[model samples]
Target: MTKEILYQKFGYVLDDSLINEIINVGVFKSFSKDDIIIDINQPMLYIPLLLKGHIKILREDNEGNELLIYFLEAGETCTMSLTCCMGKSKSKIRAVAEQDSDLIMIPVQKMKEWFHGNESWRNFIIESYQIRFDEMLDAIDSIAFLKMDERLYKYLVNKSMLNESATLLIKHQEIAEDLHTSRVVISRLLKQLENEKKITLGRNKIEVISN
Candidate 1:
């Protein structure tokens, strides 16, 4: 899937030479949904380039409370991992598989070489950083300004888009954990959304109907 995946996403911007290097040096790995890929304070090693499925970026507090930072779709890499690798520092964020996923894990040593030797790679890095930074800001805004119900609905919409399905196979408890809230609160809001005809609640799935 190397040629197919890369061309589908990065063909317009990434050069053939860079693509070749990726094909050669990148190690392919697969992960199951909810599997933790990056952990807090874990040493930076290889940076994962998503080939298929989705990943969720998260932040954990000193008290061990977790908050959603952002979601990564196919063709994206984690900027936090990039920063940690270059700085030779431990990772401060956590990355979890949002779905069963395939990825190409590129060695950290090649990060600098590719950045300098390939203009396309450099642009990709810069652009990725900007994109992640903006998403981080949006996460902050949701927590600060948006009401819990609004945040929950937006989360559902984003999750639905990432999963490429209107029906989400998830639990209210999982939603509460991701949003850093209580299960009771999430259940209440979910019922409210159902009543409003924004979504339909099933046994273990929520089908997004409108927004």
Candidate 2:
């Protein structure tokens, strides 16, 4: 998309000069579905501005289990990664492409420079943090207040929404991995959901019929 379009989509206004500065400093990159954008414990090199498609921020345990923390869509920048970038610290989470995606990578130096030089850029960063912080809170609430079955159902609904379809072509093992549970547990919960007429399960796919 054009810079003007992206600015509009992201609800920001940038003059030609600032736009040119962004164009000059940002490197465009693409990733396929399931591609790892950021790995756990890796130092952040660049801040990503997602231009198209979707990504998932994942928190992984030392035992290699992963939990889906949040979703980053087009025009959203991941505040967690940006935090690591600013601090020059290693990442505590992983970022993965949930679908084919295009993004612009702003080098750490330029990210800092923009924050210092542009008031609008600083506001953008602050807003990004607030958004992600709220999402993290929601994640926490889900874990604290919701039962395992409820969480699984919510996760499937989220995936269905993201895919823009009621039918999701995914395996129970993958769902288990994302939810940080065992495959057998996920399978049992999925069967329960199916029996409740909330979803219809196939060999490797699930079709949401209700909540």
Candidate 3:
């Protein structure tokens, strides 16, 4: 895709010359579904622009529980690269492709050059950070203020809106991790929701039946 298209999709624009320079320095890569795009504990060096497909950002706890931080669809860049370029010793999260994907890897040096030379690029970076920060805060608020059922309800509602099919393709374990609750608790709450005619559970999907 052209830089203009990418900018329009992301709701931010970059100078044409700078965008061209970045494209020249970046490499296009394809990954299969479930492929690890960024590994944890590694030194991140490239900013990956997801051109196609969906990805999940996750981190594992000491007990080996994987916690989902966020999900990124096409047009989002990996945040790990920004953290690394800012002098982080190791990446704290892992990025995995949820489906067959295409990505553009921009070298850290190229990003620094753009940041130094293009005010628009710098503003875009700051805006991206602010957005991510707000998301983190919202996640924290959900964990602290919401009950498991409420969290699950909101998650289902969001997924329903996104897919237009009431069913959510996420696994129960993943939902538990996202809500910082146990699998048993999530299962019980899901059953309760179903009993209340709020949702329906299939093999691996939960369909929201009520708002």
Q: Best-fitting candidate, measured by TM-score?
A: 1
Candidate ordering by lDDT (highest first):
1, 2, 3
lDDT tens readout by residue for model 1, 1-211: 6778987877777899888888899898999998999899999989999889889988888789888899889989999999999999999999999889989899999988999989999999999999999999999899999999999999999898877789999999889989999999999999999999999999999999964
Q: Which residue segments of model 1 deviate by more than 4 Å?
A: none
Give the per-residue Cα lDDT of candidate 3 at 172.
80
- Writing each residue's lDDT as its tens digit, candidate 2 over 1-211 gives 6575457655463445666777778888999999999999888888888888899999987788899899998878999988888888999889999989988888898889888998777888898899999999988999899999999999999888887899998999889988888999999999999999999999999999853
Worst-scoring 10-residue span by lDDT in model 1: 1-10
Q: How many pairs collide in each candidate, listed in order? A: 0, 0, 0
lDDT of 2: 0.87
Global lDDT of each candidate: 0.91, 0.87, 0.76
State, as a TM-score between 0 and 1, how close model 2 is to the true structure: 0.92
**How do the predictions measure up, each by TM-score?**
0.96, 0.92, 0.86
Question: Looking at model 2, which ten-residue stretch has the lowest summed lDDT?
Answer: 8-17
Which residue runs of candidate 3 sit more than 4 Å off their true CA positions?
1-12, 162-164
Q: What is the lDDT of candidate 1?
A: 0.91
